[model samples]
Target: MSGGSKLWGGRFQKPTHELVDQLNASLPFDRRLARHDILGSLAHVTMLARQGIVPLEDARAIAQGLRVILQEIQEERFVFRLADEDIHLSVERRLRELIGPAAGRLHTARSRNDQVALDFRLWMREAILEVGEGIVETSQALLDLANEHRDVVLPGYTHLQRAQPLLLAHHLHAYVAMLARDLARLQELYRRVNRSPLGSGALAGVPYPIDRAFVAELLAMDGILENSIDAVSARDFALEFLADLAIVMAHLSRLAEELVLWSSSEFGFIEFDDAFATGSSIMPQKKNPDVAELLRGKSGRVFGHLMGLLTVVKGLPLAYNKDLQEDKEGVFDALDTVALLLRVLPPMLRTLRIDRGRMHTAAEQGFTLATDVADALVRAGVPFRDAHEAVGRLVAYCIAEGKTFGELAADELVRFHPRLAEIVFPRTVWDAVRAREHPGGTGPEHVARALEASRSELERTARWLQQERQRIDEAFARLLSEEFP
Candidate 1:
């Protein structure tokens, strides 16, 4: 269909060029939102009928036609055509074809502006929940690893140099903390996205006596947009959702980068399972962390999507512009990118291998116990500054002699600092680890408490997620019953 031959083509005298039609076609990507667009249309039609704006019989027929379309789309029988600009127009054009003139009434008191806005919000609500589930799954994987490796020690780094000793469990749980914040941000985005904008036709309120709250209820939105201009003009929800996704992907990339580093032969700190790694084409003894590398690389694309949308919406005026049509491609790209990452990361983590012996050995090679030695001296009435300088001298001496801190004798320590006594020397790695008994430290008791707390938080988040899913399902069920009953 040429632009002038399209449904809203009354004012145009000439047909739009074929090049413009191809350029404007969103059916290839936005077609993924077909179900959401149909659902939003059903809710709007029901509200129109209840308010006597459209005949109840027309509403019933439209609802029935949309249900059939949804089923066809799901069954892979529906063919989206490029002549239709987007899912909104494509579904509307099909509904008109299926049910005759009454299908035209479905667009009453609505514009492509508010219609697409509603579709995006509905899609994002579901997308955020799915991403949250991915985060929960990843958290559980880390929790399992932490439980299995609670007693294993690893070197914690600063500027890529080993600076301290910590339990492997403690190190893994740090990711859990980062992900918990990510989950909270996603939930917040859902709350903001749950508001309805259907009554905002184009950039102004529709003249018809439509009940926006009733439509909001039908769509299971928490509230209605109070101002019509603000409703159609605002892409804040999209911006916020994309920004949240970018942040989460960044955290994931950081973790993936570390996994890549740890799996290297130079570090020998980890050994990923064959399922998550790949063999080099030319090297006989190479297992690359290909999954982690991909995840890290994909993060740049997600960030680009976020920035692209921000730039598109930054200078637009207080109304729906054709520029708003540019919103879908970037938002769709970001959603797809994040969803794919979430789906793959959990399984990769679950299958990856941990080299506990290597981690323990690396933990001991550096002067990771220097803090413990300094603390021991502090307890022996030596000032902390003095103890720090004393440990620094001893570390330099050990480096020159090519010996580990643990290999130095008590007399050797005394040679660096005369104030040092026999009790300052730790006999084993476990002795050094157990010495850190402060709360939130990597001591055994502290790690156990943290594990319990993390388990409790996960349980709470799971309950909230289940309830939100049920709420959305029930709202759709009600919409179906009201129209088809």
Candidate 2:
């Protein structure tokens, strides 16, 4: 159908070509939002009848028809037609088919502009909650892994070279920190997405006595949007959501990359469980970290989705535009990508094997205790810069002699710095790993303290997630009672 000769056909004479209809249709992707569109229509129709814009009987029939359609959709029995351009048009056309003229009254005071705005906001509000829950689940998995491996020593790296020794729990908790920030961002996005934009018809307030706040409450929204133009034009929630997804994906990609590297024979710091790995076709010994690699690869796709939506919305003159139709695909893709990662990553992480012996051996070989040695010199009254330079020369001499810094004999240490004494050198590798006792240092005591702090953070995050989920569930229940009961 032509844009004008379709459902809203009032000003045009010609029919749209089949090719044009297929090209412009969003029903293929946006059908996922069908339930939200129907819910919004039900609320709008009820508000219309209460305002005397539509008869009460018509509103009742329209609501019944919508309820039937929702059931069919939930059961996967509803047929989606390409003739309808998007979910809004598809559901309205179906309503008309079911309830005849009563369906016509359902759109009396609403425009597709504000109607779509409301539908998208409602969908995103729910999606943000789901994404937040998924993040929390993944965070819990990381915390569990951290708790299991709190004492496993690993080499921490800077510039891809060993910098110090650290507990594996500390490394895993870094991701938990990133995910915590992601959760906070999603919560803030929920605050913005919770506003209702139902009364902003097209680009202006509708000429009806409908109560916007009543519809907002029926939808369980935090508030009604204030400005008609801003309401219809606002897509900041979508952008914010995509941006947060991009950031979380970046963190995931970093973790994935490390997993890939650590699983290599050169590192041998970790091994993937058979379920999360794949064997090469020709190489019998090749069990690959394909899951981690795929996770890393998918990060680019999510980022591309974010940039695609950003490009689509960057310069559009608002109310709504044909260009905005491009918005759903990217948002849906980004949501799918994040949801899939959230579901898959925790299982993969939980199953992976940590080669703690290899990690410890690597940590021991890198002279990761050089910083502790430098600090020891500092404590012995040497200025920090002087100690650092002295350590640097000692490290160079050790490398030239094919030795670790720990191999320097107490008497041999005097060759590099004559002020050194026989009691200066650490007697054991583990002693070297534990010598720097400063707070937040990688010393044994500090690592234990860090582990405790991480455990406390994990508990706090779990409590927050539980409370947030309960709050959302209560809001959804209130919406159900107000709108459906």
Candidate 3:
């Protein structure tokens, strides 16, 4: 069946072409916004009734009709068809069918243009919250794991070469810092995405005195969007969101890349818990870090989405163009990608079995104490450049002799520079790792403090999320009671 569209059909004498219908239909992807559409419509209709633009009885009917549609959609009993085109039209069509002519008043002071902007904004608000929670979840895991491994020393790397001995906790908390910054980005996005675009009425401001502010309040938005054209046109919010997500995915990819590297036999720093690892069909002994690899690969996909959206919205004169329809699919995919990645990573990390021996063994072999030796030279009144060069020679000599730092005694170390013998030197990787005990250093004490701070931050974030979600929920409850009660 063609499921002929009537919403925009009045001027067209004939039905839309079959190919055009299939090609242009957004219902397949945008039906996910049905709930958000109804929510926006209810707030809009309620405001219309309050403004006396739509009669109170009609407003009630529209609200009731929308709620009924919401229930049907929720129950999957409502039939979605190609003709409905998008959630706005699908919802309006159903509302009209249920309440006769009064439901036609539902679009009283709005256009699908501003309505969808409102819906997208509402969806983005919830998404930011959900993604924030995922970030917290992942950060909490990192914190707990860091706390658990505070005493374990691992080799820190630069250019994929071991550079220094660091506490495992410090290695883990680096990701916590990245996530903290990403959360800040999300906070700003949440603020930006919470502004209401309702009453913008296609491209221009609505007539008949639509209560944009009241609608904003009912929808829990921060305020009305100041420019009606910009309100419906700009998708910088989505760009910012995807940009933030790209960075987020980059962080995750970096971490997942580490997990993949760490679990490899060449590194042997950690072993994945078998449940999270995949086995190769051909190689009986092969245990693959597929989860981490996939997470890393998925980063590119998210980055592409960000760039794709950026490409889509460029050079467009829009107070709502068809190109804007390209927005939701990328967002939906990126949201699912980040959320699912977060869901798997925390547990994958928790189940990981760290090879303390392998880590320490590797930490010792990399001449990881070069910085410590340099610092000792600096303490002996050598300038840092000279000290760095002196340590560089010592490291080269050790490598040439097939000797590690531990094999070099203090008396032999003095061969590099006579000032080195009078100054402190780290005799072992453990000593080198512990020597930098300053605040924020990778020293055990510093890591313990950082882990505590991370735990505290996670707790505060949890409380904030709970409170914010409660306010949003209460807004929904109040809106529901007024219309449905």
lDDT of 2 at 384: 83
lDDT of 2 by residue, 177-200 (tens): 788889888888888888998898
Model 2 ranges with Cα > 4 A deviation: 1-3, 422-485
TM-score each candidate: 0.95, 0.93, 0.96
Query: What TM-score does structure 3 among the candidates reach?
Result: 0.96
Best to worst by TM-score, what's the order? 3, 1, 2
- Residue-by-residue lDDT tens digits, candidate 1, 1-485: 11244446669777667897787677888898898898899889888888888898888999999998998898999878888778888888888889999999998999888888888889889888888888888888888888888889989899999988889888888899899999999888889899998989987789999989987887778998788888877888888988998998899999999999998888888888888889999998888889999999988988998888899999987787777777878888888888888888878887767888999889887788888888888888889999899889888998999998767776887897776656555656777778777877788888888887987898898888888889899988877674442
Q: Deviation in angstroms for 444 in model 1?
A: 1.6
Output the TM-score of candidate 2: 0.93
Q: What TM-score should be assigned to candidate 1?
A: 0.95
Each prediction's Cα lDDT score? 0.84, 0.81, 0.86
**Best candidate, TM-score:** 3
Q: What shift in Å separates residue 270 of candidate 2 from its native position after superposition?
A: 1.1
Residue 280, candidate 3: Cα error in Å is 0.6
Pairs that collide in candidate 1 are none
Each candidate: RMSD: 2.2, 2.5, 2.4
Better of 1 and 2 by lDDT: 1
